[model samples]
Target: MSAWLPIAPCTPRDCAAHEGARRAPLAAAALLLAGCALTLLGVACVPGVRLLAPSLRDRLVRGWAYAVVRAFGVRLRVTGCQVEPGRPATGELVVANHVSWLDIPLVAAVLPARMVAKSEIRHWPVFGRFAALGGTLFIERDRLRALPGAVHALAGALAAGSRVAVFPQGSTWCGRDGGGSFRPAAFQAAVDAGAAVRPLRIAYRTPERAPAGAAAFVGDDPLAASLWRVVTAAGLTAEIRVLPPIPAGGEPDRRALALAAQSAVASDSANRPAASVHH
Candidate 1:
């Protein structure tokens, strides 16, 4: 006989929860469509204020990101010292571990910075347009020849006083192993620009104060499935710890800078409480 005997039947509560999960994705999809439409409309009007009043555009994008996160029923909690708006006294490079698709909006909601996203995202329907309008820098990670150009562009952006956000891990993990190790290639921009690398830790928890495993986008999980999980997850909270910035100037090279930032992020993630669900 197989060790796995016959499966147990679902209880009424379990069935009801499953039904809710089925509906959550539909609801989230509707909200996303509406949000994208509004965002596009706002972007269309950017030309009027692009030069005279630039910050207005950034604020609009940030507001859209906040609305999208709230619509998904995910609560965001930010801790640690925050960098003031506008260019820092020194160049700034924001580094964080990749978690779920939600990481993009979560970071945008907190900070106004151009993201360095994978090139595949550039063709992802409405989101691609939105990201492009928001000044995202797309890179083909698989192409070795493209690294120098991307790095140079990133360095230029940082030197121009733009806060650039990058996920050095190159891929998303299930928030296990503290998001694996950070890749040092992206850190080259910081070294070239002499920017300060600020590490941010992203953590997720359920309403019951447990790890929100359902919210993790790992393995072969589809985008729709992850969205359903997030929407149906009760009181899912995303905790963002904005750890102190490490000066790139002190590092001997890009690899050293990358290691230092990775250490800072891992240490912070280790010290924080496992579950950070706010009441």
Candidate 2:
């Protein structure tokens, strides 16, 4: 992989030219088609398709996501995925630090859950619609107003046996510039609902020598170019690690529990072992 890989805005002219020249239109098209197909599949699942069990939707989505990345010529590698034996049973909140847009499908591949995403995602071209159909909850970020609604909605979901995933970084950052940190708000839903919070970490390792901020959509990088670089560049890897589950511990204060869970995730990402491929 090149050293300076761009994320969403800026792209190296050389990389663009190379990708355009050697680009596998079929691969990209396949991804586009598969994305649509998966979205449809989610809808189909709602009407008794029953191919994906009630508790397995998240993993099914993950499988579809892996297929999407593979179709785009990117490899998906997962490590450190294990549910604690004494951990609260399934159907809880899964929280993690937000790294990239890729985290959605990446985590979904491991745990099935309805994502708590920003309301803006509801408007995304293809993804937003698909996420909605996949049981994602888009909420406003305003703390005071959104907190109650978030908690209520999430509690009901968990009580009804739905797994929910939230990014509590308060914003997106890949831990560079010391940019990433888990926000307490992300854990509010789980804490309020007395649900176990499973922390996960997402990292992108590029084989090319792309710049640090290259793969990020921030800065002047074009979305198309950054995406192209990721797809075309060789040795692009997306890794997801599901750390130990944090029991609610009777803590009503979501912030404290959120921090504890965050630390657990950071530790897992830093010290936990790797995951085996599940074909």
lDDT of 2 by residue, 199-218 (tens): 77666665552322333444
Model 2 per-residue lDDT at 256: 81
Tens digit of per-residue lDDT, candidate 1, span 52-78: 444665676677777767777778877
Q: In angstroms, what RMSD does candidate 2 have relative to the true structure?
A: 6.6
Which window of 10 residues has the lowest lDDT sum in candidate 2? 1-10
Clash number by candidate, in order: 0, 29
Top candidate when judged by lDDT against the true structure = 1
Top-scoring candidate (TM-score): 1
Q: Provide the overall lDDT of each model, using Cα atoms, as 2-decimal numbers.
A: 0.71, 0.59
